[model samples]
Target: MHFLQQVINGIAQGCIYGLIAIGFVLIYKATETVSFVQGELMMLGAFLGLVLITVLGIPYWLAVPATLLAMMAFGFLVERVAISPILGEPAFSIVMLTLGIGYVARGAVMMIPELGTELQVLPVPYRDQSVAIGGLIIGMERLVVPAVTAALCLMLYLMFRFTRIGVAMQAASQSQSAAYYMGIPVRRLNGLVWGMAAGVAAIAGLLLAPIVMIDSNMGFIGLKAFPAAVVGGMASLPGAVVGGVTIGVIESLAGYLLPEGFKDVAAYVVVLIMLMVRPNGLFGGEVRKKV
Candidate 1:
């Protein structure tokens, strides 16, 4: 029973990691650059939600959609103003730029006087509430996080698999020049992908805030997502989900069965093992050389 309970906890945590990993995979697929700022974006989203629900007196239900939309627009603007102009530069340049963006985001949050310097609890109705079934107890947050993550994943799968914009995004990811030649409007799709990634990150923030305190530093959770992405396959969306669950489960088991502090490094240990065993990732396809 204790083991089962731990598994539940881990699954929820893994779902959060998976949500952030999706942001990483989305940006990488669209532009071949990883957005290290994803964690900070998650942080910013949580703060925005806090402001909406706590400061502005908005309802939690309404605050969620508003925050998501705002983050989407923020993402598009980030790409246009900061990311787009440097498209032709070296990949490392973009990477550094993203790191700078992350610092700027964190700094911006901290500059908000009262809000930035403090830890906050999102006033979700389900906060601290739990239910039990079959002699096992479960937190509402544990149940909700995985359910929402699964729903989001399904929605994304459907959109990418069925929608015209999804198809265009796919083509653009495959080869931008070729996609542009085919009239796919690759630049527009890139902006949309960035917005989509940001929106997803915001949802992740909202779901996670109730489970943990919403703080400026919560974005550091993205570090775990980085391992999840690598373990699952940086370029494979399904792989992100798999990797997240695996990491989450391992961390949970470690915290329960091993000494204290094992949970912190368990994800990275699995990542190293996965890299050694399957360098291309569980779902990553064949690598190619342009030369």
Candidate 2:
């Protein structure tokens, strides 16, 4: 029972990691460039939610969509201003640019008066609430986290499966040159993808702020989530969630069963093992070699 309880806790934590991992997968799919600042984006989203709900006195319900939209626009700006100009540059340059963007975001957040650099709690209705299912107990945030993540994933799957825009995004991801030649607005879609990634990061932030207090350093969780992306195969969307849960479960089990410090390193250890064993990940598509 205790072990089961820990698994539940880990799943909740993994859900958060997976949500951020989705941002990694989305941006990579759209532009073939890895954004190292996803964690900072998530952190910024949380701060936006906190400000909207607490500082401005907006209701949580309204703040949710407002914050999401705002983040989406901010994401679009990031792509246009920072990422778009260097579309053909080497991947390393883009990666470093993103890292710099993240640092700027963190610094900008710290510049906010009274809110920056201060620890703050989000006003969630379900905070401290719990339910008892048989002999096991569960916190509301823990239950909600996985549930929300699952729903979001389902929505994304459907979007990519049935929507015309989804098909265009897929085409662009597969081959931007071909997609553009086919009359698709590949560059515009790239901006939209960045926006989409940012919006998703914001949603993750909103879901997570209730579970953990908002802080500038909380973005460090993105470092842990990056492993989830690698473990799941950077190109596979569904794999991100799977990798996150796997990492979460491993971390939880390690913390309980292994030495005190093993928990922090457990996720990376799994990543190393997975990379050594199956670089493609559990659900990752095979990379076809060109002649």
Candidate 3:
């Protein structure tokens, strides 16, 4: 029973990692850039929800959509004003820029008068609820994360598989020049992709806030998500979720069964092993660069 409980806990935590990793994969797919700021974006989302619910006293349902929309707009603005201008720059520069953005965001959050220093709990009605099944107990908050993630994944799959805009985005991801030449509005699509990624990050933050206290440093959880993206394959969306759950389960089991700190190091150790054996990731495609 204890083992089952741990597994359930792991799965719920994994769902959070997977959700953030999906943002990583989405941006990478659209622009081939790894946005290290995803974690910060998530932190911002949670803060947004906090402000809406706590400060404004907005209802939970209304706050949810408002937070998501605000995040979507913020993402679009960041891409258009900050990221898009440097699209042709070296990849490392773009990476550094995003890192800087994250630091600035964290600093700004810290500058907030009342909210920065203290940890606050989100007022999610489902926070303390749980369900029991044959010696196994699951928190409703935990169950909600995975359910929402699965539904989001399904919606994303359908968007990519059947929608015209999705097809255009796919084409742009494959080859931007070709996509532009084919009249796909590649630049606009890039902004949209960033927006979409941010929106996903917001969802992750909202879901996570109820589980963990909302705070400026909450973005650090993105560290775990980085390994999830790598383990699953940075280029594969489904792989992100798979890798997240795997890492989550491993970490959970290690935390329960092994000595202290093993869970924290497990993600990096797995990444190191995976890189040694398969550099392209579990689901990554092999690419041959012509010299």
- Report the C-alpha displacement of residue 152, candidate 2, in angstroms: 0.4
Model 3 C-alpha RMSD to native: 1.3
User: Model 2 over residues 1-291: C-alpha lDDT tens digits?
Assistant: 999998998999998899899999999989889998889999999999999998899998999999999999999999999899998899999999999999999999989877888888999888899999999989998899999999999999999989999999998888777898999998899899899889888988988888888988788889989999999999888999999999988899899889899999999999999999998887787886354
1-291 per-residue lDDT for model 1 (tens digits): 999999999999999899999999999999999889888889989999999999999999999999999999999999989998998799999999998999899988989998898888989988778898999979898899999999999999999999999988988887788897898878878888899989989999999998899888899999999999998889999999889989999999999999999989999999999999999888888886374
For candidate 2, the 10 contiguous residues with the lowest summed lDDT are 282-291
Candidate 3 residue-wise lDDT at 263: 89
Model 1 misplaced regions, further than 4 Å: 288-291
When summed lDDT is taken over every stretch of 10 residues in candidate 1, the lowest stretch is 282-291
User: Which residue pairs in candidate 1 collide?
Assistant: none
lDDT to native, each model: 0.91, 0.91, 0.92
